[model samples]
Target: MRKLQQRLDKIKDNNQAADALAGRRSEVKPESASPVAPERSRGRRRGWLIVLGMVVFGFVFGELALTVQGWSGPDFSDARRVGKATVVSCERRGPIGWGIGYWDQCTADVVWDGGFSGRYAIDRRNFFHADEVGTTVTIGEGAGSRGGGVVFSRPELPHRPAVVALGWGLAVIASIPILLLLGGTFVAARDAIRGVSKR
Candidate 1:
């Protein structure tokens, strides 16, 4: 009888321990789940933020590079100026590389009809979306136009430095958000790891 009683007591003790364990697990599971849902939400938002940042970075960087190059393209200031040419044809074509949107290459009528027959070419961005077919385009005799430090993009504005300070300005503006995103990601990850460890 004593042996049987001892066996019953042992069984009772085991049951109590199991119940306690189940209780603890049930309590912990809810708390862990709550935190996890929020973390996953944050992770999703951060992923999208990173994607958007990359797109913006690529666009701004390309424009910045193109603008700078436009400002510094071959100098035609010393051009042998075969003669002034009137824009005969203007066609919009996709950018070959590092170019932003629409680009136009114009074939100008070099004053060959009057003297020597020849053709000249000049290209510019379609900023105002204006028709330049009738516009007079300067044909460079040699290769570049370097007399002026900047080409007057705007007839009214006069001179614009190659890679206008604006490009740097946009880059600086774009960087602030990206830097914040990176720092936020790092901090969030650290905090998340720390939080998990505590659990």
Candidate 2:
């Protein structure tokens, strides 16, 4: 009987040991199989998103700044006549890498009546009137024609509505990409922040 009792006690201890080991394995498994890999991948994607957003913003909007500056100049409507000049050459200038057809710029080089010469830039309003080489155009100087930048003018200013509407439509269409890029970047950043807080 004593021998049987000893055997029973040994079996009980073995069962208890097995139970303890199983509990420990359950705890360890949760830790080892934790969902950490996906979190790391998400972090990497968010980092890339922010970086790409900034680069695209700088590249696209920076070019817009330059384009606006180039298109603007002093008003010569009230200026006195400096001299008459002959159109030497015709060329076009605009922002590079994007918005090619949306924005228009036409420039001409002219030789002044007094044996002097300089390049003249015209805005979109006068782009259609870009003169041919050797054509005569008037030059107007700012501040009563005393000393300032010159402006070029043509004899006739024709009104064309179709070209103006086309330019406006193209400009509106070009803005879509910029809006989408910025919106996507903002959403990605917000999601990343929310994920971090949850953790």
Pick the TM-score winner.
1
Candidate 2 residue-wise lDDT, 79-193, digit = tens? 4445555555555544365332244344556565556766765554333334455666565544523555444433343223454455445455546656767797799899999
Highest lDDT against the true fold, candidate: 1
**In model 2, what is the error at residue 191, expressed in angstroms?**
24
RMSD of each: 8.3, 8.5
Report the C-alpha lDDT of model 1 over 1-199, residue by residue, as the tens digit.
9999999999999999999999888887676667888899999999998778776775677566565544433344534443556767766766545456566676666663247755545565542223767776444444324444322133322235545665566566656666777787899999999999999
Provide the TM-score for each candidate, comma-separated: 0.49, 0.43
Clashing pairs in 1: 68-163, 74-144, 74-145, 75-144, 75-145, 75-146, 76-144, 76-145, 77-145
Candidate 1 stretches greater than 4 Å from native:
1-11, 23-38, 68-73, 89-105, 112-116, 119-121, 126-138, 144-199
